[model samples]
Structure formats: structure tokens, C-alpha cells
Target: MKTTFISTQAVSSATRLSIMKMQAELAKNSKELGSGRWADVGLELGNKTGRTVSLRQDFARLDSIKDTNGLVMSRLDGSQAALEGMLKMAQDFSASLIGVRTGDTGADVIQDDAKNNLQALIASLNTSIDGEYLFAGIDTDVRPVTDYYATPVVPGTGPKAAVDDAFLTAFGMAQNDPAVINITPAAMDAFLNGAFAAMFDPAAWTDPTTGWSSASDQNVRSRISTSELVDTSANANEAAFRKIAMAYTMVTEFASSNLSEGAYQTVIDKAAEIVGEAISSTTVVMARLGTAQERVKNANDRMDVQMKILNTHINDLELVDPYEAQTRVTALETQLDMAYALTARAQQLSLLNYL
Candidate 1:
């Protein structure tokens, strides 16, 4: 074996290098011990870094979806509540129409109530959540229903106008005319179930030069999850709303003096029929909303579970065993102390000091 002699300068340099390395290890272990995760994940994970990055990206995307799903759930809840309110109003109005005397002075009171209910129904249909109109379909910025009190002066311009035109064209009378009692089921059929009904159709909405026009894009949809898109809102363009509005219009206009008692009763009966049908249709829409809300809730549940699993995976990749890290930190502290002691000793071993 050949004998090797190392110079004092070389020994000092080597000692300094060893102490620096020990200090680096001490810092890393201390950080891991305090944080319970790897301080340098890339260094620790190496080839697995890509997988960790990908998992985090997935988490971010999922979190974003969950946020959107929460908003959608809120919108659905609001829509359901509004529809329920409208249905209740319609039900009450229908129940009031029963067995009413044609000469009842309460017609004014009832008409007043009908106007209030109509306004409330419009308010409900125009419900907004977080500043977005839930019933406005894709046109969230536009209100879905124009105020019912607006005169139908411009034919074919708005809901009130559409309704007024249908009545004038069908019955040869203004909507308030007592002769509306002459409107047979055949005449009311078109208003209730035919072309006039189609006017309330989402597809029939045209670009009126003004406020919300009935456009075919009525149902509002939201992506609840990566793989799922759901219709989260119902628009006001459904037949139910039109039926209610028309009935309300007729009832609010009804006065005992406008017609013979028999004719007034006939109008009341027709209003009842229309409002009843509106109630049924509103119920159906509520049922559909219930189903949609349930689907969104289920998706949220699924995402919650997936998020837990993903967190676990992320922890496995990036977290350190707390106990092990503490032990390593203590060991590194001891090694660092020993290296400092050795370096101090090395500084004293210079050849010039020996001289």
C-alpha cells in the first residue's frame, strides 16, 4: 500500500466542505420536521414529480367544478322555490274561483289579488341569484318576463302584448270586454293550447328591439362535473306561466257589471280551468327541478369523496412521517455539532501555528 500525505490546506478545505454539507442536511431535516412535508419535493420525488403535478392540477380543476356546482345548486334551489310560490298562488287563485256568485262585490277584491299574484309570479319567474337571472335561460342578463301591467300598445312586442293580440284576434274583443264570455272552449283553445300558447314557447321569442324577447333558448344548463352537464334552471316561457298570466288577466278584468250573471259565471269557470291547468304544469316543472337538484347534490357528494382520495394521494407524494423527520432532525443536529467541533479543531492545526 502506498502511503499518502495530505497538506494542512487540503485538510481544512475538506473539513469546511463536510461542515457545509452537514448544515444543509440539518436545514432540510428541520424544515421537514416542522412542516411535516418535504421541503424540496422535486428533490425528494424526482421522477414522480410529474405525477404529483398532475394530481394537483386535477385537484384544482375539480375544485373549480365544485365551486361552479355550488353556484348551480343555489340557482336550482332558488328556481324551485320561485316555481313553488307561483304554483301556490295559482292554486289559491283557482280555489277562490269555486262557487262564486256572479253578483259578488268581492270581484274587485279578487281582481286586486289576481293582479298582485300576477306581479308576484312575474317576480318569481324573474328570480335572480348572485346577480344572474335563473329563469332567463342563456340570456341571464335579460329579465325573462316583462311587467304584466305594461300596456300591450305595441303588438307582438312583449308577453302582455302577445297575450292581448291573441285575445283581440281570437275573440274580436279587447281582453277586458265582457263579450269574452262568448269565447267558447274552441276560442280559448288557441289561447290556451295553440298558436297563442306557442307565443309563450321559447322558440317563438324573437329579437324585439327592446327588453327580453322570447327566445327558444329557455332551459339553463350548467356543467356540474367533468363528465356531467345538467339543466339547472327552468325558464318562464313554459305554457304554465302563460296560462297563469292569461287567467290572471281575465280574472283581474272581470266585473259583475260587465256581463249578465250567467256570462260572468262562464268567464269565472274558464279562468278556473286555465289556472288549474297552470297549477299542474307548474308542478311538473317543479318535479323536473327536484330531479336536477338531486343530481347536482349527488355530484357534489361524489366530488367530496374523490377529493378525500386525492388529498391522500398528494400527502403520500409530498408528506413526511412526522416521527421519522423529528428523529432525522435530531441526528442531523448532532452531526452538525460534531462537524463544527472538527472544523474548529482543523483551524487550530495550521502549519504556521505549529511553527
Candidate 2:
């Protein structure tokens, strides 16, 4: 040790290494100071890194679910609005039917209102948001209801055509036939309870070409939270819609003015009854949708709380003290400056200058 000699080259190499290390530390501290987070999270957390990783994953999952729940809530809101509008239409049409039944209004007024109501109903059920039909159940790509007033109405094709065929088949005559005037109330009732009712049955209503509804019976189900799933949509195939369609079709398609007073009153009475049932059924559907909306909102609230907690834990695991980081940065800059000065002085050293 007493005889040891150190060369300029060895001293220069050591200084260069020290300068590189100081530079790296300066950059790291600067980053930490700017971001207020660990410059190297894995290195800083080391053995605890897995905990932050898991927490981040959970946070991301909750965020994704919250976003999806937003879409679900939008769909539910649109459906509720559509159902409410349809309910109002049904109520108005029912009132008109009652007016006709009590002889306070003319039958023609009810017939015109029924036609308008049916068109409005079909339009409402076919409502879409973001190109997705709200009443299509799980078949979002398909239109839920057939337009009874759709132009170029072909025979044996579409809901209106099916109604026509059912009428002719049951009564052995067209709705506008002169013989309809002599038709008894019992015959009309039989037809209404039989062939007309069967048209809205699942098998017939689901027919691809001529059915009234192409929507699925199973509604859309959405995961509102990690552990909670709920129905987020309603289908046009519900019994309430079916009854409404029947009531509208009976008044709009039947030649009511051609019928005797007794048979005409029979139609009005039955249509009014069906409209009442439809309104009640629609109310139940709205109540169920309201419940789902409440659940989704609550789930979102809980997820928000969970996400906040997760963020706090992640911050604790990864955040750096800005003051400490700035102090380290200042120290590193001072050391780097000294190292640079020493290196510059060493490079200027020469035996020739001494000679």
C-alpha cells in the first residue's frame, strides 16, 4: 500500500463512471420531481410491485364497467321514455273508445284516432339510439315492430296483411263486404277471440316475413357491477304491445260504420277493455325498468367509491415526495458539476506543460 501508484487513465475512468451515475440520478430525480411519482415504480416498490399492479388492474376493470353501465342506463332511459309515450297514446285511444261506447262521440273519430295511435305505437317501438333499436330486445340490429301503415302493403305479407287474411278466413268475407252489416256480435266476438288473437301468438308474431314483431322475447341483460346483472331493455313482443296492436287494428281495419249499432258497440267495448289491460301491463313494464335504473345507478355509485379507494392505495404505493425529489435533484446537479470540473482539469494535465 505504501508503494501503490495510480495512473491518470485509471483516475479518468473512475471519474467518467461517477459522472455517468450522477447523470442518471439527476434525470431520475427530475422526473420524480416533475411527476410527483416514482421514476421507476417497479424498482422503488420492488417486492410490493405486485400489489400496485393488481390494484391498477382492478381499477381499470371498474372503470370499464362504469363506462358500460353508462350505455346501459342510456338504453333504459330511452326505453322508458318510449314506453311512456306509448302509454299516453293508449290512454288517449282508450278515452276515444269509451266516448264511442257511451254514444258521446262518433265511431269515425275513434277509428281515425286508432289509426294514428297504431302508427305512433309502431314508430315508438321501433325507436333507436346510436343505431340500436331500444325495443329489439337482444336483437339490436333488427327493427322491433312492423309498420302497419307501411306503403306498398302486399297481401299475405306484413302485420296488416296478416290481419286481413285472418279476418277473411274467420268471417269468410272481407271486412268491407256488405254481409259484414248482418254479422252478429257473437260471430265478431268469436273471431276476435279466435283467429285475431292467434295472429299475435308467439309462433305467428315471430314469423320472419309477416310477423308483427321480430324482436326477441329475451330482453337485453347488462352487467351493471362486478356482482350484479340486470335486464336493461324491453321487447316489443310483450303482451301489452300485442293487446294494443289488436285494439288498434280492430278499430282501424274493421268497417265499423257499416256494422249495426249492437255489433259496433261490441267492438268498442272489447277494444276499450284491451286498451285498459295494455295500459296496466305497460305500467308494470315501466316499474320494472325503473327498478333496473335504480340498481345500475347504485352500482355506479359503489364503483365510484371503490375506484377512489384504489386510486388512494396506488398513490400511496407509487407517489414520490416532490420536496425530497427536488432536493435529490439539486444534490446530483452539484455533484455532477464538481465531477465535470475535476474531469476537465484531469484532461488538461500533461507532462509536456511541466517540462
Top TM-score prediction, candidate number: 2
Q: Give the TM-score of candidate 2.
A: 0.90
Candidate 1, 39-147: lDDT as tens digits: 9999999999999999999888889999988888888888888887888888888877774645566566677778898789778877888788877778887777777
Model 2, position 27: C-alpha lDDT score: 89
Q: Which ranges in model 1 have alpha carbons more than 4 Å from their true place?
A: 1-20, 99-101, 150-216, 254-256, 337-355
Instruction: Report clash pairs, candidate 1.
Output: 202-215, 202-216, 205-214
Candidate 2 residues lying further than 4 Å off, grouped into runs, are: 1-14, 102-105, 151-155, 343-355
User: How does model 2 fare in lDDT?
Assistant: 0.88
After superposing all C-alphas onto the true structure, candidate 1 shows an RMSD in angstroms of 4.3
Enumerate clash totals for all models, in the order shown: 3, 0
- Residue 68 lDDT in model 1? 89
Candidate 2 per-residue lDDT, tens place, 33-125, comes to 999999899999999999999999999999999999999999999999999999999998888776677442476788888888888889999
lDDT of 2 at 60: 99
Estimate TM-scores for all models: 0.78, 0.90
Q: How close is candidate 1 to the true structure, as a TM-score?
A: 0.78
Report each candidate's C-alpha RMSD, comma-separated, in the order given. 4.3, 2.6
Error (Å) of candidate 2 at residue 89 is 1.0
